[model samples]
Each structure stands twice: as C-alpha cells, then as structure tokens.
Target: MVSTAAFLRRAFACAAFALVSAAHADLKVGIDLSSTGPAAVIGITSKNAIQMWPATIAGQKAQYIVLDDGTDPGKAVANIRKLIDEDHVDVIVGPNITPAALAALDPVAASQTPMITLIGSASVVEPQEGKRVWAFKMAQTDGAMADVMTRYMANHGVKTVAFIGFADSYGDSWLNEFKRFAELRHIRLVATERFNRNDASVTGQVLKLIAAKPDAVLVAGAGTPAALPQRTLVERGFKGPIYQTHGIATPEFIRLGGKEVEGTLFPTQPVVVARTLPADHPAKKAALAFVTAYEDKYGPGSVTQFAGDAAGVYPRLEDAVARALKKAQPGTVQFRVALREELEHAHELVVPNGVVNTSAKDHVGLDQRASVMGAIRGGKFVFISE
Candidate 1:
C-alpha cells in the first residue's frame, strides 16, 4: 500500500546512504509537481528548491525522484502511484495545483503519507482543520487572502468589489470567498468577469468594469500569467484601486504594465532587504538571507522576489520534510500521515518568510489565525503585518 513515490524514495535514500555514510546522511525526495507538460517551470523551481535544501543543510544532497503530473488528475494519480509503488518515497511534498493536489491527497492520505502542498483549496484538507492529518500547506488559503484584502478594504472604507477572476477553480474559489468575506464585512458586491489564461486580454473586462465604477477590482489568475488585468487597467486608464489575489506575478505585472502595475498589490510571503529593511521587521534578516541564498543557488534572474517565493517555498517544505523524517520512528511509516500531525496543526517554525504555526487543528501554516500584509515599495516588499 506504500506509494510508488515513497517506495522509490526509500530505495534511493538507502542506496545513497550506503554510498555516502561518513560525512552525510542520505535522503530520497520525490517531486511530482512538474515533470510533464507546460508546468515545467513550476516543477523546475520546486525540484531545484528541494535539491537546494540538503545543499544548504549540511552540504549533503538528497536523491530526488521527480515526475510531472501533466495537469491531469488521472496522470497525477498514476504518477503518484509510480512514486509510491515504484520509488517508495518516504514522504511527498507536492503535486501542485488543486486537481493534482486533490488527486493525490486521498490516496497518499490512505497510505499515511505526508504531503506538504501549496495549493490554497480549503477542501483539499477537508474538515479544514484536522481532516487528512497527513496534509499541510506552506501556502495560505483563499479565505486567508480574502480576509486580508476585505479587512484592509473595509478599514480603508472601500466598498463595491467587482471580481475579475479566471474561469477556473482557483479563481472561482477566490471569487466565492471574496464575495462571502466582502458580504460579511458589508462591502457591496458589484460585478464579475473572466479572462483567458492563454492570450486573450483583460483590457476589455477592465474597461467594462470601470464603466460600472466599482471601487476596486479583484483579480485571480496564475502567477505571472495574470498580468493581463493590470495591463488592462493601464491601457484603459482606470484610476480606481486594484486588489490582487496571491497568484499574480508582480514583476511581470510591473514589467508589462509599468506605472499601472506599480500600486497593484496582494498577499505574499515576506521579503526584506536586510540593510534597507527596518530592524523591527518580523521577517527580519533571515528573510533577506533566503533571497540571497536563492539567487546564489539558482543564479541571478532566476525569479523575482515576487515569484521567488513561488519557488522559495520549497526549502520551507524541505524543512518540514526533514522534520518529518526525524519523527518517523523506527517502526512508524514516516509517511505523509505522520508528518501531518507534526506539520499541519502541530508546529510553528520559520520558513523563508515568517513563522508557520500549523497544527492538527489548523492546516494552513499561516495559522488561519493571523494575516501578513505587504505592499510593493520602490520594487521591494515591505511588511505591514499591523
């Protein structure tokens, strides 16, 4: 019943440990995030980040077993099965995206595998609290994002929200939660529109919504892929405020839309420049260290601090994986399930950004309890956790 990924991982780790027993301990990690089709960048970042962990840990490298889920849940299941049954992975970190995350969640959960995911879907973990017991999120949820944006807007006395989301689950999920959160806060619900993830422009939608005069537009699109709306806002000359969900690419938005993308903002992991950042910063010097380390490992121009987190989260997950490995008793499975109790609602350790206080009762690592807010200033992220 062990996952092929887990199986492969064990074999690889054992062989690696045997080969390098003196100065380093061996670990086998399975990456099923992206190895397949177009999502290669995500997979590459994920794998590279995970690989960098052991590189940074003790100059010891873990053997990695990688597979791409191909954006198909079925393919995802098959790939996970291969990793579980074939690779014998000790624990699994990701399949990325909602569908793949969901596809592998149950199967891996049943196998008592520990899965650290960044997927924001609340349902993936069920019960929202202690559902799978083996699952954890390094990524914040849509509701967490909604709460941040809505509360900020409410505090600022802004109302009338028009949703400019993609026609997909990720977007739709945010749209639903945003509306729900907005309603709870007495914010007016205006209109909603969709855009293509491929090439269709959101300029028309921005104009249409601008004509409606919503106080602010809420956007939901893929990382860097959702730069369309900001571009739209500029081309059409809408002066209203813009709010973004977590996924949009800040650098791409800025690069593509220039001044229009300047003020656009969303929730993201904290990034600070040590020298320039305030000493009171919660993310502090370590956050800046992550950026420097990431650049050193990946080479310059690999990813902006915006999506740098899109990739930076991997090391955080690696810490969770290593932590799981330690607790994996001699007889215990040491799979995702065991790690779930330790990771999901059990611990609060600093990853790249801030401390992730997750537990069995709280699945999202941000603690469903606190929200971290940041604004892009002069091209850098400034924490406003107030």
Candidate 2:
C-alpha cells in the first residue's frame, strides 16, 4: 500500500517529465542562401554563422533547415515556398544578395511568413507595414551606407565622383541613394557607368571613368565580383581615389583585387572593427562576444560583416520567441504570427553590429552609430576614424 505523500510525488514526477518532453519539440528555422553563385562568398559566411546557432531558442530545441538559392531569384522563391509549405519552419532567414531578396518578397508576403533578409536594400522592409509586414532586414540599407559615404566625401574634399556598379537592382539602389545624398552636398557627379558582375574586363568603362577627371570613383557592387572595376581602373592608370561600398568587405574581395584594392574606403558595421572600437561603445561588448565565440570555433580572422549579420538573427529572434511561446506552442502558425508581432516591438536590444530598437515604423532600427568607415590595409580591414 503506497502512502498518500509518496503517490502524490510520483504523479507530479510523471507530469514534469511529460512537460519537458513537449518543450523539446523542435523549433524549425529555415534559411535560404546564395551558396553557389555570384553571391557565394557572402552566402558561405552567412551559412557558417547559421551553423553556429544555439541548439535551443527560448528554452526549446531548434531545428535549422538550410537551402541554397544559387543566387537566382526563381530558385529563391521556390526555396521560400518549400520551407513554408513542406518544412513548416517557424521562422525564415536569408537570401543574402539583394536581387534574390527582392524576388522572395512576394512569396514570403503571400505566405504571411516572417523573413529576415541579409541584403542591403531598404525596399525589402519599407513603409513598416502593409505589404512588408512579414519582412525584416539584417544588413544595413544602401541609403544608410550612402549617408556615411557622402559625409566622408564632404569632409575629405571630394567635390566630384564617378560611379560604376552592377547593371542590376543592387547598383540601381546604390546610385539612387548616392545621388540623393550627393545632390544635397553639392558634389558633382562626373560620370555614371554600369557593368555585369561577370564581365571579363571593364576597360571601356574604366576609360570613360578616367576621362571624367573626377576626384574620386565609387564602385557600387558586392562580393568578389566588385573587384573587377577597381582592378581595371588600376590597370588603366586612373590615379584618383577609389571608393567602394560595404559590399566588398570579405577576404575574397581583398585577395582577388590584391594591391589594387588597397586603401579602398567603405562604410561598415562596428563588428568589422570590434577590437578597435572603444570599450564604452554601445555595440562593443556584444561585438567582442560574437567575435570571440565565432573565432574560437572557426579560427581567428575568419569572421566577416556578413557572418555578423547572420549571427544578428539569433538575438532578434530570441525576444520574439520567448514572448510568442507564452501565446502558442512552437511549430504552429499561431506561434509564427505571434513571433512576428513580438519582433516588430523589440526595443533597446543590442547586437554585434548595432543597437537594435525595432518598431513598426523602423525595421532595421539603426542610426549613424551602427557604422564606421574602414579601409583595407595590408589585406586587412582597418578602422578609419572620422
């Protein structure tokens, strides 16, 4: 015959075991990336960061399902559909390059799935609500990059600039933002040119840019492909200062461009220069923490801005996941919806790159504090104090 106290204890133990088992149910996270095409360099770093994600989120087991989009928009859309329809991922991240992220917008919006894009396009999450309610961006927008670049130019006495970028939306977005800022600063746009990322040579474009006789040249492309224009410019003896966007911050770009890319200036997040940042900087603590953890696993000097962006998704999802878990169980549509709502309300959250204070009106939620100017020195990125 069991005593009453002993019977009660056994019953409570069984209930606790059941609850723990239920909590262990997988929280699926889907990631789509450009792992094998023009954007591979960017995608690979992002994938590396994703692989390092914590096994648990909001105290529940997590399952991350990754897919390669091949840097194609059609394939990216297909992957997003599969992740939602088949895998039933609670949340989605990635499509690193801008074009793919733009193409994925419709599918993600239609499915009402929240997607965190790694591209540098404000159009990905504009107007805060309505069409883009389900979308968020991890990377800094082109407009933000333009702001800092223009300010640097104004202070550095660059009165005229020539522009060369990819002949796609990425380039178009940069041109639009740069033009907007340049006009306000009274900077003359000497020449504008476009080229395909896979172009064998940019001799013709470089010649035209040189003839413009601008004080500086801005290359508005990303990844390894962005090196082509600068190299051609060097070969053609264009002696003007050459500037690049944050797109070409990876080691591959530096290796490919070699000495030609030396001294190239660009704007980037604080993570790119974590160690050099002041101890009291808002993102310094978080930035160093990520760098330490990532380098400990992947070896020193392997981290990139793209990887930092990928790592950013975890904290962005953390608060949302914790709040959503109270309303609905993971793996359910209701939980995903609740998570989206919570993400929009995330405030005063610090990450490796910046202090994220997301709101319905601002998804990226970063100001000038998020970025610092950097230059390539001896094949490494060095901070350039303003």
Candidate 3:
C-alpha cells in the first residue's frame, strides 16, 4: 500500500517545472482505462462515471484522450508514457486493472506526472517501502475487503469458511489475505477452491466444497464465470450462507444464475444501494446520487452495481489530475510534480469514500468504511450494515 506520508515526501522530491507561455492553453488530460474488448464492459461504465462529474470541479478543461488498454500492462505503461512525454497531457485518469496500474506506477511517479487509477493492490501505494504518490485506487483494496469479511464472519458465528477463487491476481491476493486474517481473527478456513477464468463448470469444485460443509463460502473471481460454483450450489439445493468479493456479485450473475445468486451476500461499497445519503453524511449521499444517475443513464434493471466501480473511479482520477494541473508551475516536470503533490489529499479533504486519511504517512487513500456488506434483494443490490 502507498503510505500517504512517504508518497507525499517523494512527491515533493520530484520538483515542478516552469509553465509554457499562456497561448495554446488547453487542459489536455489522458485516460488509459480499458475502453474496449473484454474490459470495455467496465471501461465504458467508468468512462461515463468520470465524464458525468463536472470537470471544472477541480479547475481544468476536460480535453481528454481515452485509450484502449486491451488489459495488457506493458501496453498500459507505453500508452501512459506517450500521454505524458509526447501528448504532454496535464494529467491522467487511468489503467483500471491493478497489474496494469502497477506497470505504470514507477513510470508516472518517476516522470512526476500526477495520475489516479482504479487499482486494488496495496503494492501500488507502498511499492516496496518508499511511497509512490502518483498511484492510487478509485476502488477499495482486497485486503481491506477481507478485513470486513472476517469481522462480519466473526460477528455472525461463521467459524469454518470456504474460499472459491479465480486463481487470478485479485483472487490470489485476497485468498492469501483471507488466510492471514482468518488466522488472526480465529476463523477456521475450512476449504479452498480455485478455477480458471474460462472454466464454465465448477461443479467438481463446488461438490468438493459442499462436502466440506463450510459455514459460509466466499467467492473471489471477477465475473459470472466465478459465480459458477455459487450458482451450482443452489442447483444442488445446498443453500448455506454465501459470501463473495465485490466483483462476482453483479446482476449479471443474477441474470446468468437466475435464483442461485438471489441470497448470495457480497461485500461492496455501500454507495450503490442508497438513492441519497443521510443529510449528515455526504459520502453516503454522493454514492446514492451517483448510483441513481448511473441507473438512469443506463437502466439498472440490466446492470450490475460492481460495474460502477470502473465508472466511479474516473472522475476521482480526473479531479486529482486537475488539481495537479492548476498548481503545476510550467513544463512537463513541474506539472507532473504538481500532479503528484496535489493528489495527496487525505489530510485536507475527503472524497466519496469516508475518512480517507491518506498522506505521506499513509499511501492507501482509503479507510475502513469504504467497504460494506451487500446482498441481492429482489434482483437488485441492497446494502445493509449487517
């Protein structure tokens, strides 16, 4: 995780440049999010999420370049460099995947370009002890998500738990985390299963886990494919409580699994469930309003709230870039430096998530409340503290 303090310190170490003359001034921003191919399903949602927010909110013209990452890290790094060195973009909005986000971390921070991304790995923030200020997640982390799950499990008397993971970067990361936290929290991890992302049948694994009879099963893959076992259990009439990471708990699973996913409980940010937050809570309100607008723009009946994670991060990415631009003195170096500096805001402000107290000391621009327990109710996500 990027420690806020160390990142801020390094951000200051990367000095700013003198600005170019005021003539051809246009705030050109570059976006390297997944916009096409398999990732587009998420990229388009995030793209709209970024655009829906008022651009000038952070003080910058919304001139942008959205690139298709093709879900490749090397390509993401190359594109990000081009945007900074060749395109001379004032800031950046993305490269959503954590591995892809990892590829660009050193490049953007070393180049001193302030950028935000939809990453879930803590390595991006800490990046080997020193802080990489320019990198951050528009979404929450898997470890933190694990923390919530463990706490919930402990609270609910769920002692023996099973984990079904995709064997991908996200799944592996969290599976390891869940084991570690399980030990710490005294929760016995009864069984574990892994499946390929392309596997259409997880019946064998589901049967294996069913035999284990875990108090609860946690699914950690990315899409409907990961929800296979969760769905199959229902087919076999095995209906113990089911838990999952935010990724697989989409409406697509509901449409794909039909009744199987109906009662599956998943951990997700509460922002999707509320139409507006309580008047006293701005973040809650922001999440509700954002979800409402998103549903209005693209009918919710057919969409999954988890997809919104992609959409929701872009604007946050843009805002950081905009701030960096306004404070950047001149030239690529200075602007990049400013981008790095302005992006560190846990001390002064809180964005959509709550208590985001990141700084040079903390690189994880997140807090505990960024995650909440959610369930699919009547075919839609319903957030409940329980």
Candidate 4:
C-alpha cells in the first residue's frame, strides 16, 4: 500500500526502536562476595558459577556486577548501598558468610532490592519480618543439618557431645539447633565453647572440650577457617568422632584440615554428591546438569557445593523474572519491587541445591530432603546412608 521509499523509511525507524529497547532491557544483578578475605574460596567458587550463567535470562539480556566485600560486615553493607543506589541492581546475591549477609539486610530493604543469601544461618530469613521480607536464602538451614548430625550420633552411640564453633551468628544458630535436636534424641551436651573465626589457635577451648571427654565433637563453622578447631582437636590427640556443619563441605576445608578431617561427618546438600545420588532423586537431574556445565569449564572434580548454591540463583531468578516481566519491565523501581514480590512467589523450582518453594512465611523453602549426610573420606566427600 506504500511506495518503496516510504516502506523502507518506516522499516528503518522500527528497527532503530527495537535496538534501543534491547539496549535498555538488561536485568541487572549485583553480587557482593568476600573474594579477598577468609571466605575467599567460597566467594571465588560462587563467582565462577555466576560467570557461567547464561547471558540471557527469560528472553531478557542479563548483566551482573560483582563486588568484593572482603568478608567484612561493614564492607558488605557499603557494597549493598552502592549496588542499589548507584548500579540500581534489581536483585543482589551473596556476601558468603552469615555476618555479611545479615549486615546487608538494611540496605537491601531500603532499596527494595531482593537479596538471595548463600549462608547457612536460618535466622537470616526466618520470621520474615520487616527487613527480612526482602531477603531469601539458598543454603540449607542449620536446623536441617543439626537434625541429621544428631540422628547420626544417636545411632552411633554418641551419648554425650562437645560443641565448639565461631563466636558469631553462624555458631550461635548451629548451637541452638543442635541443642534442640540433641535433647530430643536423648544425647547429652557435655561442653560448649566458642572461638573467633580468625583466631590463631583454639588450644584453650580444645583443652576445656577434651576435659569433658564427650563421645563426639561438633564444629559449627564455615569455609577453610572452620578447619581450625577440628584440626586443633586432632593435634591434641582427642579421638572421639568429630562432626562439622554443612558449611565445611568445600574441598578447601578438607585440604586445610588434611588427614585430621578424615572420618569427619556433616550434613550437606545432595549436589555435593550428585553423581552418587540415585537416578530417582528429585535433585539428581538438575544437579547433574549443573555439574556438567561447571565441570566442563572448571575441569572434572573442580566443582564445589558452594558453586552449586551460587548457580541456583540464576534459575530461580530466571523463573521469577519471567513471571515478573508480565507486570513490569527491567530498569526501574517498579521492576525491583515487582522482582521482590515475584521472588517470594517461587514455587516448586528445582535447583542443584534443592527444591525451592518460597513464601511469606518461609524464605529458605528447603526441607529435610535437601540435606544428605556426608563424610570426608580420603580427601573427598562421600554420601553416608543408614
């Protein structure tokens, strides 16, 4: 119905508009991690997983801006402010440790940016109060880990246990859950102690623990630093069974603890032992898919459970963003708020870590099926069954 010149002119304008829309439509995600501090190993693995995520999410271009928080809570809070105020990121992920993640709650809620934390502290998102409404968690809860550990100890005739962990929130959460479950399992708590994550030694604490002569010991800490207490116990020639929380599932922890960590038991997400999981396991298929993508890049046996936790954010974000786009587009305050609401709507989403089904009442969303008992054997993680 139009002349050649008119049709050509109209087509050019339509193409230009499409290009402009594409340029401004990227989903911006900010990552604050402890890349240079004590939790560097965890941060590095998480960053690696983020780098491997698909360039596009739910048909929209995705852009990620990663910042190092150095594992400091103050730095983590500052990083969240910058991400929200300057970068205008719709969602923020991580600051590997529990303290950093907890410290970030204020800034995240102020900007209405959805935060997905990769820490084991269930309190980070529990109660789902004012600020917590903006936060979600990826790691399995300490309660879930404690339940598995206590059951394992009870079945193994561990009548009494000693507990030593970081003098921070991670340790507090673990101790509380372990105590609750241990009492129910009829296990006696003989001694309780704490140490700083960066303490040069835990000799004094270890001595007190050995004096109690408990049947077993539980170290509630994360990353390579968690190895200090258990390694010190072995050095002290205390030989009852030793257990750790899921936080120490990384290879760096095993390497740092060396032979001292052998036979050490813990509760971890099935992704850590995905290859050994039964074909019918709900998490097996998704976990194996991530393993293939990750190992293909980082080499066989280089994949860590931390990477699985980080990789989980991508699919969850993708699923939520897809639904959110129906109501809002990226790059605006409305988009950020909509993303937060949509994230809470995540239901039955399978990830390498677990099945996610977040809601107003529960943010972590993982159940007992998310945890499987594991032990460090011959410098590798192996699944343990009843």
Query: What tens digits encode model 1's per-residue C-alpha lDDT throughout 1-386?
Result: 11122211222132112211223224444556654454444455555545443332213255556677765668888877776776666556677666677777776766666666656566576565343666656666788878887888888778787778777677778888888899999999787888755556666677788888888877887555576787777678777777776665334445555566667666654542333455764544455555555556566535433333334344444545555656653124654444455455334454444556665666665643234555556654445542
Model 4 error, position 24 (Å):
4.9
lDDT of each: 0.59, 0.82, 0.64, 0.83
Worst 10 residues of 1 by lDDT: 1-10
TM-score of 1: 0.78
TM-score per candidate, in order? 0.78, 0.92, 0.82, 0.92
lDDT of 4 by residue, 1-386 (tens): 10122211222122111211233547888889888888888888988877766556777877778889988999999998998898788899997889988889889888788899988898888878999998998988889889988888888899999999999999999999999999999999999999897899999999999999999999988889899999899999999999998888777887788999999998889778888776777888777777766776777777778888988887778778988998888887788888888888877777787788878788888887688888888788878884
Q: RMSD, each candidate, Å?
A: 6.8, 8.4, 7.2, 8.3
Clashing pairs for predicted structure model 2, backbone only:
none
Ranking by TM-score: 4, 2, 3, 1
Ranking by lDDT: 4, 2, 3, 1
Put down candidate 3 lDDT per residue, 235-266, tens digits, no spaces: 76676888877665445667776777887777
The candidate, 2 or 3, that scores higher on lDDT is 2
Q: Give candidate 3's whole-model lDDT.
A: 0.64
